[model samples]
Target: MEQEEALDWTIRTRDPDFRDWDAFTRWLEAAPGHAAAYDALMLADADLPALVPAEPLFAGTPANDRGAPASRWRWRWIGGGAIAAALVAALSIGMTNRADIYTVDTRPGEVRVIALDDGTRIEINGGSRLRLDHNDPRFAALDSGEASFTVTHDASDPFRVTVGDTVFEDAGTIFNIVRAGDATRIGVAEGEVIYNPDSDAISLPAGRALREDGRGLTIVSVAPESVASWRQGRLAYDNAPLADVTGDIARSLGIRIVGAPPLRFTGTILLDRDPQRFFARAAPLLGVTARHTRDGWILKERDGPQS
Candidate 1:
């Protein structure tokens, strides 16, 4: 069968009415190729079929149509059978290497500080994902989210943060990189970092920034202390929009803020202080009043206050 036909069949097999456990088991037993096809469809990594063409799978089905209920006997039989089959496969395949993998995730309203084996300190912001290979020495990948790193001085192996084609590397420096969709905003706080893009490379010193785009790199200057302020529980901004400042605030405090724009706030507030107090200081700067609403805090223009 063609790939399209196999996909169609797989879709139909997952239908609510296709709950005949015996029939499905018999079909799997009748042909090894069928089982392989199912696995291929389910296990195709990276190149898996896109869901755009899967609309027909639910053509006539309602949204509320739940899958078939479980059967105790069927569940027990399938569970035991799977265990036996897995044991056989494991014995045949022997041991497979799964590389040293480490995941550090932060839940909403939570802050996490971790120390790696290399003596590097990492403070992960809320709603972030940090994937590290505890063994790979030459380099490591920062898959997504924002993280402040105090890299240990290591002339032997330089730390690298891979954000798309651009790679930020430094042997002994502190920096923060926030991955926002296609673009990555990097702020160098201490020492120097090499921002490399393909064949080109640019050295970024402390209090400097380099924004990477599809075309090339754009260099700019930033205050080093402001970028590293997260370590001290503070959101420092200078000529930054309300949107950008709010994002940093939400990440640092693990709280959500929703309100209108034109909130031009530019100042530094100690994040360790009470969140409400921080908002009070920020609101006056932005010409807005901070109020507690159903969803965290909302900053709006004051009703009436003489300048």
Candidate 2:
């Protein structure tokens, strides 16, 4: 019954003519978690606009038809089966949105460039997933992997990217965000950005980057030119551990790295879009040698002097 009421409020609040704020506020405050539940339902509905073809949904409907009933538009666009299928997809991915959301997913070793409706652009790295709200052009959600965003600023509707509970709010910026496991790294290339990890918010300007994880936030200096190096088939690592570099290489090449011998590596590794070339250049720097096997590349400590 509570869930039903919350869903009702979710639909009702979106109605332009529904102005009963006092009663709605009273109902929301009357129970704990009601507002949260309502918010979740609204978020779920936001993705419904994207599940169906826009032509069939809006063909007969006249533009700027404010006089038409809200239920008419709701039934026209949403069907029970469509909603069920969309819900399943959303639940499986842990991301939900209205019908007007655009999503891009890339396979391992595949990179994609996305031009959004609002003139904002995104470069999605290998094995990454990105979602944008079409209705609210300023909002986006990065579900996993890495992506670099070049936002077309609108101060009235500030651009925001949500990664887990953390939010990166742009102040007219170009930034790269990488999500590996539970850790997230944000690098600002141009202008500045406001990062909110849970309740704490921090401002990061150009040439600065930060990583957040279970331990805490660790800020670092990153060259602005290296912000989206992956787009050019290069990776710039500044004092990064061997394991992290290996993981990136594996993802970028669509190959697994086995028996990785650890060593401190700090330099810009040019991938050249060739897995073998990358391994040849990277192995010597880490005091290791790469042996290509049937399964994948195996890194072993150099048999003689460091290559």
Candidate 3:
């Protein structure tokens, strides 16, 4: 009886002119499972017609034969079949949507490349976490770290990435995004993207980058090649702060760096297979010495002179 009422509500609510939303809300809130049952019926409404033939199910039934015992049994069987068909359809749709959620994570010194069902490709940098929903192929969430995306062209479903409160939407583009603490930096390599925050939306085209922090948003032009350079085992820094660069290196190498003297360096640093070797090469360039401890590498000021 409850299922029957739920099905009735589903049909009524689907009407184009249905306007008793408050009453419907009251009905749904009246019982705990009422809403779930109605939702099942709605899914069945979409899928049951495709799987079950209406002509064969209703064609031979006559309205005047309701008094006969066999006729009553036949009607019950048909009703049961319809409800069963709707339940099956609802379950199938639920499974399909839930199965499309894909999650991938990377450890330090590891990079992963994923080719999604929709032909979109994602390069997840070391120590990054990302979730992609194939049901909504163009939407994803970056929980932490950095990633580069080569989104397939699907005008119907533009690519969108959410990092905290900020959203980056692209029609079809190659872009890189990094999330560190409260700061987010997005760089576009190919095509364009729309950067949206609470206040406004900014259109960023190829060879441009945007950084958002406590102060505000800043836009700058960057070389396309400089974007996602970590894919080639190199990290390029152009006047980036010491804190930011060390943080990136630590994440990439899967190690910890502490006591880094405050100084900024500008150059490309090759990430060798050995984390110690990379640090040994990088430290002296900044006029610092690399000391290896149990925790990780520590950068200290060189005794001679500052670079």
Per-model lDDT: 0.62, 0.73, 0.73
lDDT of 1 by residue, 160-252 (tens): 877766788884799988765565778889998888734566788899876664655667788898886777777776666576666677777
Q: TM-score for model 3?
A: 0.64
Clashes of 3: 0
Using all chains and alpha carbons, the TM-scores for the candidates as numbered come to 0.61, 0.65, 0.64
Worst 10 residues of 1 by lDDT: 45-54
lDDT of 3 by residue, 163-203 (tens): 98989988579999988888898889999888982357688
Over 4 Å off in model 2, which ranges? 1-99, 303-307
Q: Give the count of colliding residue pairs in each prediction.
A: 0, 10, 0
Candidate numbers sorted by TM-score from highest down: 2, 3, 1
Q: Model 3: runs farther than 4 Å from truth?
A: 1-100, 197-199, 303-307
TM-score of 1: 0.61
